[model samples]
Target chain A: MKEEIQDNLIQIHDLRISIYSEGSYFDVVKGLSLSVCSNEILCLVGESGCGKSITALSVMGLLPTDVAQVTNGEILFRGQDLLKLSASDMRRLRSDEISMIFQDPITSLDPVFTIGSLLTEIIRVHRNVGSSEAENMAVDALEAAQLPNARQRLKSYPHELSGGMRQRVMIALATALNPAVLIADEPTTALDVTVQAQILERLRERQREQKMGMLLITHDLAVVAEVADRVAVMYAGEIVEEASVQTLFDKPQHPYTQGLLGAIPDITARRGSLHAIPGRVPPPQVPPPGCEFAPRCVHALEECWESRPLLEGSGEGKLRCFNPQPLIT
Target chain B: MLIVLLISSVAVFYAIRLSGGDATAAALPGSATEEFREEFRARIGLDKPIYLQYFAYMGKILKGDPGHSITNNASLVEMLKEHGKNSLVLGGAAFALVFLIGVPLGVLASLRRNSWADHGIMSFSIAGMAIPNFWLALLAIWLFASTFRILPAAGCCSGKQLILPAIVLAFEGIALTVRMTRSAMIENQNNDFVRTLRAGGLSEWRVMGKHVLRNAMIPIISLAGLRIGQIVGYALIVEQIFSWPGIGQALVTAVLRRDYPVAQFFSLVLVVLVVLGNWLADTGYTLANPRLRRSR
Candidate 1:
């Protein structure tokens, strides 16, 4: 077992996951490698069902039973292989060492529980604290997440709060123990434009204060542009490209990445038609073997349809393509 | 306060109308003279205006003496109290039986949606829905009382006897509850929050228990509330059929003899039970939904 034992907070090697459907197993995430350093944000950008959220869920060991299964892979956290850990041990590690905030806050929280109960449950489970003290800490965490009226709001139920407030409460619950890593899976997908911005901003603020590593899975490129330090472009359950955000945006090497960038509508651009990807993201059940995006690639070559490209580093960026898109002059 | 009073007065008016004003005030076909009828009307305070009579009845009811039965001389309040207890016991037991069996089965079927387990449970639910209550009650009596002779067939007593009637009473409720729970569970399974909880590192049990069950229960609570009155009403029929000396059997006796006061009192008790059931359901719903509290 090769263990990269430096400052890496999380490291995954040769992780392979398959889903059971219709009496057959289909590979959802092929052999994939990823690393997240402490106090950094890694963004996974892709269209829907690209295995980005699946990868994040795998790291938390939260894959649903009867469908998704981690067949092969080793998720190492703090020099310990997560898959090998006992369920009892992993339960302790989940909310304390690595926490997660979901996409929709409205439904994520229990309707019967007050915000105070929800927040305090996490605190009491992970921390050896009394209820009164835990409640005070929960309120502080909520305030840290920038929720107004933290004291009064704690008494309110999740439905009593606005969408934005509920999201903040979720953040507060996830961060009450100051976990080392936070996985936010499409955290702003359900919110309005303005609320989305506020939630992202709150997440970034909390990440910086806690100096916690974050694996943010999202389909929205704008969100990634605003928050990511490194961006991994996923296409049909594979990371086609990985590079620093500035490098990926400044000089996109993958045709899929370029297509995504092109698809982003700019409000300031004048007299220009909005660009769209030619077709929808292909369903994962029968993903094309050779380059999944070859069918949609404007710059596709014959080799792209015959041979799949392994992720190879060329200069400052890595891309999995036979012929990476050339830099625009 | 005004609404409650207005509603009470309306109920009273309807009750009086249904009983044909006052039987004693009208002259008897063969025995009573006009002078005797007029004197009896004055004695009973029926000679006064309807509105004044209403106030006097309301006063007596509030003071806990709901007047005496015209035929039996039994106090309406006492009769209601005795019969209401039996009804409550039967209804409560039936409810317990229905929910205890229904909820878990519904949840299991939902979790294993489209599986054989789901199909079997649904078939049972359908059977429960199709079977009529009276027939089921009679069947219970025949099987337990007449055929095997293990139970007495009717009356609120310990043994195999209560089982059949309770089961018969609960069968439809269980069916309703199971269908509701299964559908609610199915709906909750697809909720984004449930997905989110699963993604948030919760195990399947935790997700279902904490998120799915709680949310799914909201609708079930409302359904239970609406069904409570019906269940109690059904208890009356079941009790009469089974010779269970409960409210319904007593009601039949009172109604058959045209004991107007006793009948009216029993009806009022039922209405009160229904209203109270509704109130409890509302409170339960509010407790389950945070959005409701915030809106209020």
Candidate 2:
């Protein structure tokens, strides 16, 4: 158990992020904690505006400093606190130790730069290699990402390629340096259904081959079911429930998690009306008292409205609910 | 471009003719008799109808003969060659000053955005846009030439004399370029690509200079081209103020004296240069952005 805990490449401890707007600051990610281990995929599932992307940005130290801030937290990467590291030191660690791919591939790459230049520059930034060597490495990365005509594609600009191809290039760039951890924030969201599978496959292949701890952020439960080793369900800036993929799917403990599982469109059942949670995720600035999901949860108890529950668990999973739903079967 | 020059020349010719000025009278002495004026007008081909005179002028221009000034009989081509050199020099110096100073300063201001430096640059740009160039030219002469006695007050014989007028001409251009560069860069800085670059651990300088600035330069290049055209118009007034012997001064003198051939040729040249500047800007826009190139 100790060895497994120690094997985590990145462990975020009680990270609280705040966003400034108009006049005052609002707590967005309220004391969230999660960990990513080598040879595993941890999917952080949440709807839009639930602070998932900002959390990923905070991990990369790429948050917009003027608007968002990490008020309290410790992001420990391999035992060193990332938040305490100097800007230069943090920069040295980025892409070399941990890298990221954004949601929209079309706008994520510089339109003016050729694929070869963009890839080669990144390789050269961290390595003391000549241009030719960097180019060779870039070609290799492109090939690994299953891009056809990898060498020829080097001369291509971002707009010249299809959305799927660009996402593959993004995957190539993020994994080229063989970082220990990769944060893919809805990487395939902008892609078509057919292209999404291919991108996910390539991403999984890279993550497994490199033994990289990948933190995949997405709102799609089908994606979570397909790619996640562990699943963490976030509601209103808090992780309501987290478990192994099988455990989370088979027996979702928290009421919010149960509602999410029920909301997935079922093909077998005769469809009369789709299942939907009653209410929406509360705004960060005006979250309801006690459990943030109380208004939306169907099985909320009286105690759930008085005080928030801490994330408590042992070996199999964690649940932050005073009134957890009964286990099925 | 050639079509634009032709249309512009025709318009200038008719407009100048309809202004009710007799070129023959301007060319002749005040004591000349009506019969002598009639002979002078007939000698210069002004006795023909307006459209016929335009056709003759256009035919002569097509054959590379700009004709002679009605006032002095000096070849219009020769006057153009001599004075065009000075305008070219002044315009080039002004453009050089605009880009060399505006781009870097704009980059710095954007990188340090919302800081005192950015505020200062923006405030200076507003002031630059508000102040009149001719008034600024006079003040510059007063400060640098009359008061400090460091630079020459007027004329274009020495390189030192080019400084005051060039600065005056480039002031608004620099201000506009700075504003454009800053806003363009700031907009590009917010793009998803910049975040990708930063996440990839590229240095801030690399992210900003190589990617952001390059993207921002597309619009800035077009602005630069438009500014070049505007500088010609500004040069007219700036030249009159500084007494610098440029084509602008020549055009004004020709207009006042009703030197038809000289004025018509200079107006055509100005139109051609402005159109050519826009063409260059369009070409530069395509070159700077690969997306545009691929689309074509």
Candidate 3:
């Protein structure tokens, strides 16, 4: 890890999210915290059903209140607690200081509206501009996102474009206002592998150019390796490790983090029989009493089964484990 | 679409024949001799074979003759034209009222979701659907005309008279529209685009009115064709109850008088209009839903 400014752009502190049904509440995200500094990409890596997407949704204030709610925690952006703000006030801050793009572009853009309308409307909402001026700004944003023939694509609806092109349009819409934070919830997961690389590269380029703090959520280890400046590994509902990407991958300490790295196929050496972590993520409704990932960890200790580990350590990274192990490398 | 119209014409011809009454005999006055009636039937081509009679009916419609009335022997064209205008005005007003109330209420219900406002709107629409139109018409008349003495109980005149009939005409339609709009809006509120729009910083109103409602319109517009057929059918029934003198009223009178040509012509025209409406709805559907347009 290099010595950097460390000026955090967005901070989630002790956040807990829960889903409610039939008069009973089940917590899905339990007391988790992480940060993204300006000009950095923080990849939230986890297996499916690990509450990664819900955490990202909470940050953007997009959680459906009837289904899920942020029961605890503060999402601090620009020194303001987002959860405490009124809905209207939060809306004004959205797409201006914070924006989001989703995993599937096809379903994320309004099918009845043109790309031009979708993009320009967002700009007009945040800024006082005439339609023509907004249109020009939208065009420039699309061009900045590396969409070819950007001006003409404006009239096209979402379905008229290919998946890659639509994703590019989504990137264009999200970044057009130059928000301080961008929460991308697996933006390229629905795209082709080739398009995935291109989209990730484009996002990195945008993050660098805008000096934006990006919270990139993904389950793919390769994506985390390619794009993350920092990595946070979540299991069940809690973040188990937070560190600079190099340290998390090269000197992983937590057993779950080690398992994730091991699970990644070795493309270079062409290893046969891929490795997998034992057991699946426990359903959030009935999370284990002690360490949530203890059942899946190969090096679990008796202490790990008796009590949960708090996120500890400093400097290069932090690990939440009673018995943190050093990698052989 | 054209094939549907042609088939509809054949159905109309047989429907009139199988109606269990002799139209030509009904057309003749009681004082006429049996010889004169026979001569009149032969002159009008009614004495021809069944297929020939079908061809003759089609020919009359194509020639724009419209045949004649059974009771008064008046020109069917002029009567239809007048009645058509009245029904159009009444139907258009009812259509506008249904949308005006249904859309905003549905949106409010969906946005409020499980709130009192949501329950109120849903319960009101259900009640509207449960009550029959004739019963509603009678109740509205009693309330507005008899109890309040502010409007007429029967007959079409004044904007006030138009109100009760239109309300009766719009009741089920309004109920349908509200339910459709509510379900579609609720479905769309959970849609990806709506989430994207909301996350993009647009105001809640803008998201609901623009993004959610806009996508929901595809189904609503598709419903228009079926609605128009229903609206027209509803208007006819409503008109008879109110003595509104609309086309539906005229058709009812013609049917009772055994005015076969007049009745058949009106049904055929209605069929054509419905088919045309459905065809137009396809275009409307394409406009509202861009995905269908792109696939072509």
Candidate 4:
């Protein structure tokens, strides 16, 4: 119990989530484990349909009840299993203990409400504050997100602001309370590159100032290189490699990570040809029997096709591969 | 708005042509001779060019006089003052019923989606829309007034007298409102903002009440204007069937008698009501979504 205090701010332990559709159920998120500790940024990098977004939603206890369910495992937040918590308790824990900012700012806000009401309502909901205090908090949050005209922008509706401005508003709303853990699901993906950099910088700065644990989910390797303290490379709904960012970038241990790194454009690559993995991610209904990435791996051996390999390594780094891809550096 | 009304008057001007000739002369009593008709026409300046006659009519309207009715020689303003009051009250009550029942039923039907509650409310609205208001008015009279000996069958003098007709008028409006509200809610249900609201740690009730309803309001309000137009149109038929003596019933009588001044006056008032109704709906959307106001 004493050791658990230093364990994690939010830890996902063997979490498995399944989606039900048209008389069949498929596990969108296989048995997975990860954690983000205080003052750290953990990047979860995965392509679309690999269950990155669903995993984020499950942490907030907001998965659509009719379509998806947590079949097994638990999400431990501050040592309490979030899966077993009451709905009312989860409601209170959210926005106060953990908050989330989503990808598309255009449709992520209630278009009918002004920013003032949207931000202040959350403050009033969690704290016994007067309207003036709530207003002050909202203005402070807007300014913290590095937005201009914070006072006037409070009265602007979602549609009145530009996409970048709206994303900033979302950041302000999510971070006003300074929660222990912040889940940002591709928050900068919908913005142009210039705005993207500014948004991420603000996010990193806020994380540093507040020392909040951040689970930043994105498939942009560039983003991973820029802000990740640690990186978990996901393929086919499973984490294939986990390590400190420097180690993962310099000495990727799994073939899938190697393929991803190789796929990045390089000046040395010859014309009309690029190095990319040959196959697509297998459909959930037809996943490979063993290692999920085996079909696309160049290092696949006989036993790699026969059984799923458990994640193995020291606490500092890990890899799940039967035939490893050694570093060239 | 005044220009729009003036343009709409061209349609009304054509309507007079469809009635054959000067409705003023044709509307004279059978006992009156040609001498009286000519004198009456000249007195109203009907011998002038068409544009002059139109200007004369417009000028008359501006002076707070709606002219004399050819039906009973009653002042057009006085007849409308009495009968229009009845129609206005009935229209207001029916409009209230449109939202009071329609909005709630719509919200529930949408929230429940394909459940039994959704099916039930939808089927009820379909039946409401399918059943003719005149037929329903007769049935309401038979059941609530004639058979049960409870509510009065006709007239707008008493509160009880209005029940049968008001219900008949509101039935279709409720149906229309339900369909609009349901479709709007369903459209907004998949919106990403709704998901964002839920992730804010807000309760389910607040999300649905504040967010879903607000996003769904623009369509609901726009449909309400269309519903008001249909209600006014149906009120004409419903008033006749129930012998309610409302403005719509009197307008029908005026049209049938080809009472030119009175018919034109009724058409003008109705057009105003519709324009005003649409204006109110637009105002509602702006108030509901502040983005529209900022753009304005």
Candidate 5:
């Protein structure tokens, strides 16, 4: 509701998304909140089960209707609550304004359709275009993604292409509409380090070309380092720290952030046992009552276990901690 | 492609000759003798050695001059040309029905897994698989003709009469397609692509249609192809029960009357249809499965 920027493309506020299954039970995504500004890459960094992907799916309105429920949330995209839109309207927004590229390339595409068929299907559906025109657009998209033999590759099936090539094709499909926002959920997780780099480069190039705002979700800190302009560190379905990529790397604030940075094997640091956060992340079903990361925080005070920490701050960074790290400014 | 067709044709010819030899050995009391064999051989260009006969038969067939039926004295090629269209129409219509109804129902069942709709489809599928085609045809006759007086029990020529027989034929096809489709869909529902499609802002129905449904239907298409031959086989029985004047009925009449040429020609026709069905299935498999093209 509080969209501060006049040029902001997406504004999400106190987005409390919870997936209820069976009887009125299990809230998978517990009161998560995040935002991505236009033309900026916001990396939603979290371990598995921290509701990173849930938040992304909520934005897309693609969650399974049966087991998943957005109990409460405000996913404001360009001053409209996407959750309240009609299914048709939501669909219109999905492939046009917001698109997503998933992690695994091998399984993301339909094995039965040629890349051309898949591309043309999407292109034709979203635009009033002829098959030939759509195909030409697809070829252009493929070339833009740095894929070789755009014409021949279009005729080929997903399996015929290499892992990197498949990912590139995925990028092409995602960006074909020149979507204003692209949500890439662990897009390079399934590839080799080299292929991952190539996929990332291709995606980055496409993103730059379209000047599209991107929400890059990944658990890999290295990946976050490689592409993220800003990073939001999620813990137990809550963002514990959010800051500029440079600020998060050079001056991590929250204790969890510090612990995460310390845990990274630093060749420059002495070869002692690497620092690690002691406990595992709490399960979503029965997350700790107070700050979700408190139990694992070495600096946990008496009150830390009794009250939840609100994500707060401005300018340089934000940290959700009872014992907040002072901002130098 | 032509070579494979030739080889398959030769294999079928040999199979028929072997079966025919067994019949000749028994030489049913009313049947003709060596005189008949000589006549049949000369008629079929089979007086020559097996290999030569194979080439001659194939060469003639290629030239659209397939030999005459030994029983009815009808041209084998001409008979197929006359009746093949009807069989194909029935087969194609049945296939369409199965796909149109079965696939969507299968997908719905998968989407609403464990729901009443799923339960209904699954139960129907089981019953369809369990009941024999002849029995199903009889039941269809009783239900549509005897009981409801809504449709003719047999002899479908007009598009209107096609409804009952087509539905009867499609019972098994639907069962096979639905069951396979449901199982395949359930399997594909677990695939990462479905998950990815969902993650990519695709609706459940769209994900099911574009990703899960197509992947699931791949196996079904092959099964359906194989079943088309089976349907052709079953068509004979159904045609007999319904008194429909299809190729199957003609073949049965030939067999009963000991019309050797007619029986031989019908058998060959069936074999060719089976082969063509298999070939069509292969091409379909190639087209449906991007994995094949992708692998290439």
Candidate 6:
């Protein structure tokens, strides 16, 4: 267990984020804890507005200051607390130690810059390298991302490339510096199914090549099944379950995780309809007094409505529920 | 573009002609006999049908001859060349002042957004835009010329004298440019790419100065070109206040003196300048935006 904790490249502890809107602040991410271990991909599975993107931004120190604030908790990168770093220190650590790729590839790159300049600039910023050396490194990164005509693509602007190609460029850019940790927020959500597979393959290949820890955020369960080594299910800003991907998919304990697994449309089943969790995730501004998923759970007991459940468990797994669904055979 | 010029020339010719004063009557004195007036009208070809008169005027213009001023008999082309240079100098100085001051001030305001400096700069710009140039000109002359004894009260052709009127002309332009730069920078700063740049470990200066400013320059360059045309329009009043010898002052004089050829020539020049300004802006827009460049 101690060795496992030491292997984590990025560990987030009880992170709470608040967004100021209209007149007051609301907790968007309540005391959420997760980690990304070296050579493993931890898929943060959640629906939109469940604070997945916010969590990623906080780790990168890219959250907009006027709107969102990290009210509590620490994000530790390799045993150093990132939240305590100064602005310049955080900037220095970013792209050099940790990097990120965003969801929409269309708007992720600067339209006015050529692909060559964009890649070269990031390379030069993080490493003490000249332009020619940086250019070579950029070409290598592009090739690593499996981009075709990598050398010729240097002069092309973002608009000149197709969506898939741009996303490839984004992946190349994020991995260019060979950071220890990579945070990808729905990286394949904007691509077609074929392109999505290719991009995910590239990401997994990059992780294996570098032994980098990756926090892959996605709402698609199929994607979770494909690339995740471990899975953390989030509902309304809190983790409901954490386990090995096989365990989570085969025997989802938390009611929310079960509902998520059941909601995935199965091609082999001759069914009446797909299963959907009954109620929506409650808004953070006015959350109910108990477990956030209790109102939507089929196994909610009388005690589930009284108070929130602590995340408690033994080795390799954790569960936060008053009454969890029974294990499947 | 040629079609627009042709249409504007026709409008200028007819509008000046229909402005309720006979060219022959304005040229000849009341003591002159009807025979003298008739001879003058025939000499200038005004006795012909109105359409023929218009055609004659156009032919002369196409031949690079705008006829002569009715009051002084000076060549209209020579007058335009002399006065056009002064207008160019004044307008150029005013334009330079507008951008050099406005852009940096805008950047500062945006960087310090919602601070006291931002509020102060914005409030000043609002007041600058609200004040009329004529009023501002008068106030400047009173303060700088009459009170301080620093500048000449009214005149032109000197660097020192250029200062007062140029500031008066550039006041509104500076205000407009500030608003434009600040808003454009703020808008681009909110774009998704900004976050990408930040997450890429770029320094705040490089991100804001290089990327954000480059995107912001698209609208700014367009505004700059349009402002050049507006400066010339505003020059008419500014020159009148300063008694500066420019094309605008020349146009006003020609109109009051009923110098038809000179008035028509100067008006056409102003129209051509405005059209040229818009063309420059379109070219600048294409240059600043890569997407537009690739589309073309």
Output the number of the TM-score-best candidate. 2
TM-score of 5: 0.82
* C-alpha lDDT (0 to 100) for residue B47 of candidate 5: 70
Cα lDDT tens digits for candidate 4, A18-57: 8999899999999889888999899999888898989999
- Please identify model 3 stretches exceeding 4 Å from their true place: A1-6, A268-272
Q: What is the TM-score of each candidate against the true structure?
A: 0.85, 0.97, 0.95, 0.95, 0.82, 0.96
Fnat for the candidates in order: 0.41, 0.89, 0.90, 0.70, 0.57, 0.79
Winner on lDDT between 1 and 6 is: 6
What does the lDDT read for residue B16 in candidate 2?
75
Question: Isolated chain A: TM-score per model?
Answer: 0.95, 0.98, 0.96, 0.97, 0.94, 0.97
Q: Model 4: which residue pairs collide? A: none
Candidate 6 residue B174 C-alpha distance from true site, Å:
1.4
Name the candidate, 1 or 6, with the larger TM-score value. 6
DockQ of each: 0.36, 0.87, 0.84, 0.71, 0.41, 0.79
| Chain A TM-score, structure 4 | 0.97
**Interface RMSD for all numbered candidates:** 3.0, 0.6, 0.9, 1.2, 2.5, 0.6
Per-residue lDDT of candidate 1, residues A99-195 (tens digit): 8988878778777768887677667766789999998999899899999989998888777778888888888888877889999999899888999
> Model 1 shows how many backbone clashes?
0
Weakest lDDT window of 10 consecutive positions for candidate 5 chain B: B21-30
Residue lDDT tens for model 5, A97-119: 99988888988887777888888
**Candidate 2 regions with alpha-carbon error over 4 angstroms:** A327-329
lDDT by residue (B1-296, candidate 2, tens digit) is 66776687788888878878888768888999999999988887889999999998889888999888888889888888999999999999998999998999899899999999999999999999999998999899999999999999999768899999999999999999899999999999999999999888899999999999999999998667798898988988999899989899999999999888888888888877888888889888889978889784
Against the true structure, what is every candidate's RMSD? 4.0, 1.6, 2.2, 2.1, 4.8, 1.9
Q: Indicate the residue-level lDDT of B69 in model 4.
A: 82
Candidate 1 local lDDT, B1-296, one digit each (tens)? 34654596568556654666455633244477878888877887778887787777778777888887767688877877787777767778888988999999999999889999999999999999998899988887788789989878776766455777778889999998999999998898877666545433456687787778988999898767777877878877888888776777787776666565666667666667677778778887877665675576
